[model samples]
Target: MSTPPPALATPLSGPRFQQTSADLYAQMRRTHGPVAPVLLDADVPAWLVLGYREVQYVVSNPEIFGRDSRRWNAWDRVPPDWPLLPLLAYQPTMMFAEGAEHRRRAAALDEALGAVDQFELGARAQQVADRLVDAFAGRGEADLITEYADGIPLPVVARMIGVPDAETADLVSDVYRTHAAGEGANEAYARVRDKVRRMVESKRRAPGPDVTSRLLAHPAALADEEITEDLLHLMNAGQLPTAYWIGNTLRLMLTDDRFAMTLAGGRRSVGQALNEVLWEDTPTQNFPGRFAVHDLRLGGRQIRQGDLLILGLAAANQDPLVRPVPQASTGNQAYLSFSHGEHRCPYAAQEIAKVIAEAAIEVLLDRLPDVGLAVPAGTLAWRPSPLFRGLAALPVRFTPAW
Candidate 1:
């Protein structure tokens, strides 16, 4: 039998952290076992949990590893300029709450999302997809990521929350950049937050059959400030990764001959295609800004109180300890794509994400059977944000409808 490896000594964000490579997973497991210390952009020390069981342990035991940033190291050593700050910094939403507070806020949010009719949501998704395809079908070639993938979610989400599509369409165009490193990240975040807050206010005054109005009506009776924060989180959740899931899944269908054949044969449902991506290339990759509540030893490593802990959903999905059959799609909660625990994404949100992605993608494939990548798959560049795994662009050519 082989020996277990020694835990890595220094916090290192080695090259593996940058790319989606099998080599990265191998290195993470070999160098540090399941859990390892790694540096965030500015050499900020944090634990990167890469094992399937190990990640489940951290997320499930929130009392030990809390989500509140106030509990983060008292040193205040991590600066605002830290590149990962945009993604890691705590916010006053269900994603950052702990204990009873988490349950309370998550329920309020779920109720708000539940007000959305699934059939309408799916129909709207297809409508958005149809509009997008009409915009470029006559051109014969277009960038699917920007022109299509990124385009579907914003309008659909806007309609769900009572926000007019015309008002949010241009603003949300920059939503993905909120978590990206470098210029305008903070400004982009602020802009989208302000815009969503306005929608909440609009809902308060006029109240409609949309999510924002439902949140105002929920018994949780959240203050406007809390509501704003929650809606901002929702905007982030509803837009960014869902957009990428559509793109990544489309990439699979267009480039992977296996998926292409599956689509052509009509033997597999589009929902199954989406589940396969959620298993293999989950778009909502790494997330949750969990912090250790006290000095403790976990996964063969000593974690200090306040030490930042991030769940490596992407890595965990590919963890060797777990056998994930990507081909098997039903009820694969085993993958931490949407995360798990008290802070898991709401079931309503989950339903919308799946239906929207599946509907939008199915619309495109049915309309443009001959669509294909303009550039080679390897030539595509993934956005560098550590939070969401997304492509920079997916240039594709389709037989012109004109």
Candidate 2:
């Protein structure tokens, strides 16, 4: 087993990570070089890859840095109640699978997501956006994070996976709780998995034209347990980031004068804002990641076999070596927000997220032409979690319309 992280390693969690993570990354780079030694909850040590090239290397060479969490050497030190257990625990899903098994699961998922009708999905997103806006349109004031951003993506995703409309409201709440990483996070994760399991069972009895149903009928012959676990991953992966993408992009458009001028029916600026968020404030800031298969050197650090390396995605995006001028990211798609390599988010899934996020913003701007932040921008608080970056609340006000 690999040795524990050095005494001087930085703990990955705390209030310092909530808002100013870029600064934290800069400090780590200054202190520990590209691959900095870091600690997770309970002082479990790991490497945080803060360099753009280093992160790219880790993900690209999956043979050397595997995705299997079962290879972790710190499991001996981790207690049963660890908060990140739900994220790191090995499961029968593609996220943990390697070799032939990974390919099989990824192929099935790609086919399923690829078959989704983008035009139809966009219309559904618009419909969902309209319904959500209608709820607060008359009030003239609402917390966009809670009322709109959080409400848009999951319902569309749940329905796409054949989850019934009646059950979606509760599923949304459970999903948010799971990502909150606070009290009841583990319990919320369990409930979300249970719901996905039930959905898989229902799909067995009566299949539909949805992603889950497609996976069920795929020639890959994935077992029900596999499908259930993967669907859980898919739902969590697809919904949370997309919701935050919408929220972050909206926040940028509302606060930044560069984007504020374009709020009046400017599609180009909306797209620019979406891309900018992926660079500056990605939804998934860091990910519990690739395990070192054996002793090797990365970014000048001596990695031992079974060592854990957390992908510092946000840090990599902000790496001065690659992004010397942040403004140059206006139209660049080179950001690592969707990750890289064999285990990166599926292209179709990325496209689906883009469709949903774009529709959500365009429809909102259409409905509330003068939407603006109701509270001072400085008063806005981000949720306290290192693994994810999102606003706790985005209070906003606009002219009421019936």
Candidate 3:
């Protein structure tokens, strides 16, 4: 009546696992066409869905694919005092919930975010961009990732969520690094959890007109703890990848003369450029990890209950079968950069595009005629993280048009 799970195998060691995972993806694309079996972590045993179609299959089918963090073995490796389990326990937000709960929370968020005036937000974004650009206008060279990309998103998020100015900077910084790859990820999570708990308590006492306030006002719809959880999810979701997207888009345009020239001439649509950036180098390379709830077949491989399943977003976006049209063109081929289906990021793609185009790109293009990367293209360093791909720092030099 049901398909049996695939045979589970232990993953390769840490360093080998990372290299092997990357290699396996390349090999799968070459051989299997779009989807292939790969491993998740060195110590944890899990199957990675490295093709676009397979990822879509898993993401869209929650009955087969579950997003509960409890399914992950990485939990065992976390320190006993780590805040991850408590955070998950206290707030099973949409990301960690399944079925109806996930859908309900997602709907609420969509309504709240959608109700806001995007055009007004765009005007606010322009002001934020102008201030940031002015801060480094005269400097011939600066780390765009640190000075510009990272700084722009914080104020916007704070305004969106009603975080006070004094606490915004530290809170944004802690949350950004919480899920980052490396040994310090756990510690970062702890800091983020503490900050979030404090912020939630503060919001509960004095709710304002921000997203958090709106959630609190609808207490009958969601519990306080659930509200906190969703806030944390929004904070993490809104900050890190958006920062990476901004950095990556700037880097891509700076290094590629054609892209830069096109943007400069105003011929290239900002929306198209944003879409191209998402497809070319997705900020989140891997899918939000999911688990097989029952015996199931995906990409011709059988998976059983409790088995960990990872959907590869980066691999999926490049699927030949999916055949995503160039960002400049209009078509219906699926792209997995922000993912698809129930658990996918709703505002992630649009939010990134809006901020970068209306805020960052518009400011930069007007002020700098030939903004480009200062370091050699080959020398740029990508932060080593499987879940997200971005530059550690992007150094650039430009002459201000003014």
Highest TM-score, which number? 2
lDDT of 3 by residue, 1-402 (tens): 222222443232344334344454566667544444443343434566777767878887887777886665444544454433333333467778888888788777776676565666677667777887788888767788888777777677667767776877777667655655445555776676666677767888998777777776663477767777777777787777777887877777777665767756533555555666777677877754787777777676666666666677876766656654444322222467778888888764356445545466666677766677888887877666557777889998887533
- Tens-digit lDDT track of model 2 for 223-274: 9999999989988888889999999999999999999998877687888899
**Per-model TM-score versus the true fold:** 0.92, 0.98, 0.85
Question: Candidate 3 at 279: error in angstroms?
Answer: 1.3
Candidate 1 segments exceeding 4 Å error: 1-18, 264-269, 324-331
Give candidate 1's TM-score: 0.92
Q: Per-residue alpha-carbon lDDT of model 1 for 32-115, expressed as tens digits?
A: 888876655555556778888888888899888888887766325566656555566777776788889988988888877877
- Superior by lDDT: candidate 2 or candidate 3: 2
Instruction: Identify the superior model by lDDT, candidate 1 or candidate 2.
Output: 2
1 or 3, greater by lDDT: 1
Model 2: colliding residue pairs:
none
lDDT of each: 0.77, 0.90, 0.66
